[model samples]
Target: MLPISKPDLDAETVYTTCTATARPKSVRPQLQQLTVDLNDAVARYDTAAAGEGLHTLGDLQHQPDGKPDKQPGIKKPKPKAGGLNTHLEAAYTNRLVPEKSPGHGFYEQLMAKAPDGRCPLCSQGVADTLDHQLPKVVYPLLAVAPVNLVPACRDCNFHKGDQAPAAAADQTLHPYYDHNVHDYTWLVARIIEPPKPSITFHVEPPPDMPPTLAARVRLHFTTLKIARLYNPQAGPAVRTLSLNLRRWKLPSSQVPQHLLELAEDAAVENPNCWQAALYTALASNAWYTQGGYEKPWR
Candidate 1:
């Protein structure tokens, strides 16, 4: 996961802004009353996230094991219900998400924070939507909380829909708070030979890393199906590398060194990126560097 800076805007400001233009004259007072709850929920979320205790938060207890979309015949809460969860969810879907809404600028502000418009969760897909870290349907109080929203691609958001961690180890890495995970090289890849000349990615935290942190990294990799997302893309990359190697007319003896240089350059940009992992694995593999580039990237 790519680490990003936490939003400077606070929950109260966003909550008040979103609720300021609530439709239906009667619901205005009720939406206004929820401001304090939003503030308290944001505080709890910040504290629990920092302590790795978000799974223990009261709101999580109400989250169902599976999402409505995934579960057959499960219906989502109606917007007209006007209940607490519905109201808050609408605050997001109606007030914050719509293009003409007063709080729509904040939505753009959050999306703009994505590094080069790439989702931090996968660092691959375009960041076009805001995903709730704690799931707004379950933790309605944080529906408009700035810190609870993460910029993500639609695929990442769909893959992570309504997932509530059962424990600290199960929690996916938070970009804002888990910056330390990116401080070292934990993501690595292995070169597969023969039948299929492909590489697979996985997490390999350093020895000095704490066990909990290591578990979190593994879970993050698994939950997002990172290997599945990256392996197919590696095939085209290998084909490109082979074409480039031949185009440059580099000798077999120089292939490994060239691969190492590429790995170093990729690492300079992102230590844990799939490109860095792929090049590092290829540089160490004997067959891949010594004439293995001739193999058709099946």
Candidate 2:
């Protein structure tokens, strides 16, 4: 996962803005009544998230069909049509996500936070949609909470589904709060040899890192299937690097040094990106540097 600056928005502000133009006039007042409780929930969520305790805050249990087994803290509205859940979800889908909605600016602002529109979750896919860090279905009070909303690619969003963590270590790295993960060189790749020479990415948390933090990194990597998402790109990158090396036609002894330079440059650009990991692995592989890159290793 990649780090991003936390949004400058709050729950009460976003909820009130979204509710201002809530449709079905009857639901407007009901949504309005939830402002205080929703804001409280957001505050608690923020606290728990900072402390990595979000799993403890939600009293609702996950159901097989993505329904919340219970709605705690926030009371259901008078509307029988799914009550507070529907209103809050509509508050997001209708009021916040629509192009001309009052909260569209906030939506854009949140999307803009992702560096170059790349999903922080995968750091590769384009971040076009907002994903609820804690799924809105299970935590309706945070349906429109800006802090709870993260810029994500459609694939990562779909993969995440409506799941919430059952424990602190189970939680995926939060881009805003999990900045420390980026400070280390955990994302690494290994060069697989012949029959089909390809690169595969994996996480290797620093030796001195806390065990729980290390586990969280592994969980984030696995949950998002980072290896599966990165390997295909790594293959193309390996071929491209080989092509470039051939074009340069450097001496065999110089190839590893040239590749190391490329790895250093990629690391400078993005410490944990697939390119950096791939190059680092290739640079260390004597076979690849010593005339092996000339072969068709795609």
Candidate 3:
């Protein structure tokens, strides 16, 4: 998880946008009747989200043992035919946030905060869309709250879709509030060889960090399948390093030193980034830096 600065936009502005052009007939009567003031509704929604952040989204049905059952963490024993979720999905996501609509500009405005336009979740992919910290289906009032929206890459967003935290322990890092990724040495990788060359990633938090935070790191990686997603990409990155060695006419004997320098440069940019973690771990491994490393293909 990468720490991202929250967007400067406000909930009132976004909520107003959603409510402004919504046709009376198009919006559900329940929302119009109950939510007399959009501003108060947004405030209440933000308060609820702050409370929800204290707990992890409950286990999906099969995960009664306190573990999550699948990617994106939807509630177990999924919702039946009809209710508020169904109504909200239709009114909020389908109608209000549609392309070229009045509410769409707010969405675009929030997504523009992503640094380098890269998803802060993985820091490797494009920040193409936004993830609601408190899902829209579960909390319709926050459907367009700027603070609830998090810019993310397609894969990270898909894997984390609509999942709510059941307890504080299960809550994955919120890009805005969770600053561990910015200052901690959490993600680490190792080079794999023998049959082939590959890399594997894992969470290894320092001992001083609280146990709860370390657990969240594990849960985040598990929920997002970060190891599965990141390892394949690391191959190309490692091969590029090998290519650089050959291009510069540097011997394999100097690979360790070169990789250490590369990792240092990356660490200076963002210390906990997956790329930085990869280089740091590679430089520490004798096998990887001393000629076991090889490019699999062109």
Candidate 4:
């Protein structure tokens, strides 16, 4: 996954700034009181997070399904500030996700820092929502913590859910901290011979990476259905390229040049992008470049 820079803004700052906005006369004072309590709750989390990190609040004891149980004595600050939890929960779960609100909403600021607004997890979709690095229910205070919030497409966020890895190998790459994963040649595709040629995708971790990290890469791909999702896209893509070669009546030697262009174009967006890997795989294989692509279309 391509890493994104953590926003300089944190949850507390966002809460204060958001509530300080112009409000209707009816609910203005009430909303201001709730913001105070919400800020206090965030301050408590900040103190607790001083040394252990934000994820420190989520229980390390994971269920068999890989979701960690919420820690005990999980404090939900129930101050007399009437709408505190209401707004706090709403902000964490829903209010912060939409980009329509303009300049300073959490989602907008986060998206501003994204890599061309592409989902880092898939690199194919828009990073439309904020994904909590740790489940918000478990670490409610870190719900808005800058480093803990990631901009992601709905698909990647949904697939990840509240699950934490049961082991190091099960850990999905955290785009912010795991930037190196994108540098490697991980995603790859190959033509599968059959009634018609089609491509299938999978992780092909390089040999030098540690076994654990490699397993993590494979696990990330498997859990996210990277291969399952990417394979379908590859088929139509290969077909299009195959047809183009025929339509243009390109010379055999020039096929590599065209495929290389395809690969390079994809690489410009992400060196390890699926299309780059897919095109590179096709171009590298002698059978495909030598006209294996034309069989299915013609």
Candidate 5:
């Protein structure tokens, strides 16, 4: 996923928008405390270097799974039964819908700022949900924190329900916090030969890469189902797309160590060639897709 900038919104606006439901008196104090904590976190984040600290205010703890942990403590405090606002309920529900129809302005705004008009998670044409980088269930106080919101597709939203981030050395690339992601190229896609009616794909991590980058690549592959066409295998459409035969067919030894650099230059010299090269690489056999090819001798 491309890195994103933090949205320009205030705490009061978010609280009013997200907390329209009535809750118990105990909930009020908890909510207020959360609000204050989030505000302070944001203020600190504004002045820090990129990736200096966890950008969101969610508490970090170990979860059952080996992923980065979050724990949403306490349930909603009981509110007066009749005190909930019907209008607010409607508004909130409308915002939560997964489709990219004419209803939700919040989802639209988030999608407009996302990279390539695609949700990073599902590769869906439109991103209609604002996902929390750190799940709201874990950090209820930061539930409405703008810095935590990310544009996501419905499948991803459902699959990632309240789960923690993958536990690697570096955090998952927060679209807002991590800016240099484009600079790193760790995973490559490739096709598998002897394809049957259905397409098959595979993702491979570059050799000797950092644990965090490898984890991110694996997470993306799983989350998107990049190889799902080979069902019971894993991954989704992009994986199959990688298997298309019209792509690259070269030897690894011939490929240069600085291929990405050359590719960047080619992009500047001839954008079409750059696109072709990338597409070719993606469409090659699973081995080539993951490991890449050596340059050809003319």
Candidate 6:
């Protein structure tokens, strides 16, 4: 995934202040009461996992005894029909999808100045979904923390559900936090024809890189299931995003002229090394042959 800069948080602060001011003193206690109830509910749902292993609110709700009950988790709060309460509803709705929600137009305006008018993860052609770096489920206080919020494709979001605390030596690369991960490139692609219509890609480590980096790469690949595209649920997206597509298309006839030019140029500059390393690498894939151009080579 491409890296993303953190979004501006000024708007969130403004919203919070406005929300507090708009609430009448008479209703403040009621709001606090509701907040307390919500926190209690959250605590109950959260406590079920204390040494109990794999317990979920759903499991509690659907126990074999067939008695549905309210677990400790907080119930959704009811907003008052009008006035200040409606403003509170608007505040939350604004935060739901900061980019598109009109109530949070300030956030959208700030995001518009981002490099691609989208979150890095979203712009990377992955599913667009808001992700909380520190899971909101566990760290309720960070639920609206601007720095903690990130744009993520649906796949990444689903995979990361509720799991925070990055693994030791994880190379999965946080789009916002990790800055030194761009050196390695793990491209995956499959050939469709010729000597062997098979996938061929390389996981290249930077020259003299440390073992931790290699470990991180391995962890990322396995966690993300980057290489196991054959799995029924794992095919399309990751493969498309990670692999160089041109190499999978095949024969010179299918290759683009620009790519052929690039191959020739690289070969000319570093003939032996380019042919053996670069050309051989591209020649091994069908998609690479099909494109014959490399925007990333530079």
Query: How many residue pairs clash in each candidate at the backbone level?
Result: 0, 0, 11, 0, 23, 19
Candidate 3's C-alpha lDDT?
A: 0.65
TM-score of each: 0.90, 0.88, 0.77, 0.72, 0.57, 0.48
Q: Candidate 4's error at 47, in angstroms?
A: 16
Better of 1 and 2 by lDDT: 1
* Candidate closer to the true structure by lDDT (higher is better), 1 or 3: 1
Q: Report the lDDT tens digits of candidate 3 across residue range 98-122.
A: 7876677777776887878988777
Query: Per-residue lDDT of 225-268 in model 5, one digit per residue for the tens?
Result: 64452333323333443343225544444333334444556445
lDDT of each: 0.82, 0.81, 0.65, 0.63, 0.47, 0.42
Which wins on lDDT, candidate 3 or candidate 5? 3
Candidate 6 regions with alpha-carbon error over 4 angstroms: 11-103, 109-119, 122-127, 188-207, 210-280, 283-298
Task: Please provide, for model 2 over 105-151, each residue's C-alpha lDDT reduced to its tens digit, 9 standing for 90 to 100.
Answer: 99999999888889999988999999998987787777888988999
RMSD over all Cα atoms, model 3: 6.3
lDDT of 1 at 143: 80
lDDT of 3 at 7: 68
Clashes of 3: 11
| Two-way lDDT contest, 2 vs 6, winner | 2
TM-score-best of 1 and 3: 1
Top TM-score: which candidate number?
Answer: 1
Better of 3 and 4 by lDDT: 3
Model 1 segments more than 4 A misplaced: 59-73, 80-82
CA lDDT, candidate 5, residue 203? 46
